[model samples]
Target: MKMALSIALLVVMTSSAGAQYLGNYSANPYAPNSTGNAYGAGSPYNPNSVNNPYGRYGSTHSNSSANNPYAMDAPKLYDSQGNYRGRLSSNPYDPDSISNPYGRYGSRFSPDSVNNPFGAGNPYVPDSPTNPYGQGFSIQGADDD
Candidate 1:
């Protein structure tokens, strides 16, 4: 009897581990991180939100999906029913998320990412044509202290 109990407990725990990710867009649907509230600064679907320990599955029409400007260039993925599954890598809760494989919403995955921080509008990029302060800095309030 003890062995049977241990086996059952192990099965449950193991299944939950694979479901560590969170979001409606997750490939796995065992335990969806479902929420009626809109995704944003403090909602479940918000990729920037943390501590989501379950499966993910976001819809394309979700508030966060429609509002976040970052999704403009990011790739989009969908489910069988085609219900706006979610952006390619927009979930921040799942570290191993297929959508967010590198996690951090791909914070360092692309040229525009903070890790690289260089592109059309990066002010720090001296060679970028859109850099407003490329080679010059006036230090507007340096002496405010």
Candidate 2:
């Protein structure tokens, strides 16, 4: 009985030690150990390869004013650094008659054409064809007409 107890304790201790090292026993079967193109850890593409177009990563918007390819004077609002703000409809009071009504840094892009004469939601265009003014339907030659 004493011998059997000692053997059992030794087996339990040895099994516990082996179980502790189970995680480190083998290389990860899920992860490939060696490949033809070994470029360190989580590299999807060949790091040393020259033609890795998708692998390139860097900030391109550093010098916007200089590197800007499509930099042109838009008919809408803009800022000092040539950034769009809002459309011409952003500002209601001051009219950007000749120049852009909205500031340069405007997000919207509404041309100061026949769209919004008075404001965005309302244009003072005549409802009727003969009525050059915006009035409701009336008689041919009525007094209110």
Against the reference, the lDDT scores of all candidates come to 0.32, 0.25
RMSD of each: 18.7, 32.8
**Candidate 2 lDDT tens digits, 1-145:** 9999999999987665531100110112232211111242112363311112242110122211111222221123222233332322222322432122352221134432323333221233232111223321111100111
* Number of backbone collisions per candidate: 11, 13
What is candidate 1's lDDT per residue for 1-145, written digit by digit as tens? 9999999999987665532222332212132232222332225445433212221223333332322233332233323233322244344544422244354323445442322234222445543212433321110100111
Candidate 1: residue 141 Cα off by (Å) = 42
The C-alpha local distance difference test score for the whole of candidate 2 amounts to: 0.25
Candidate 2 C-alpha error for residue 88, in Å = 66
Model 2 spans with C-alpha error above 4 angstroms: 19-145
Point to the candidate with the largest TM-score: 1
Every model's TM-score: 0.24, 0.15
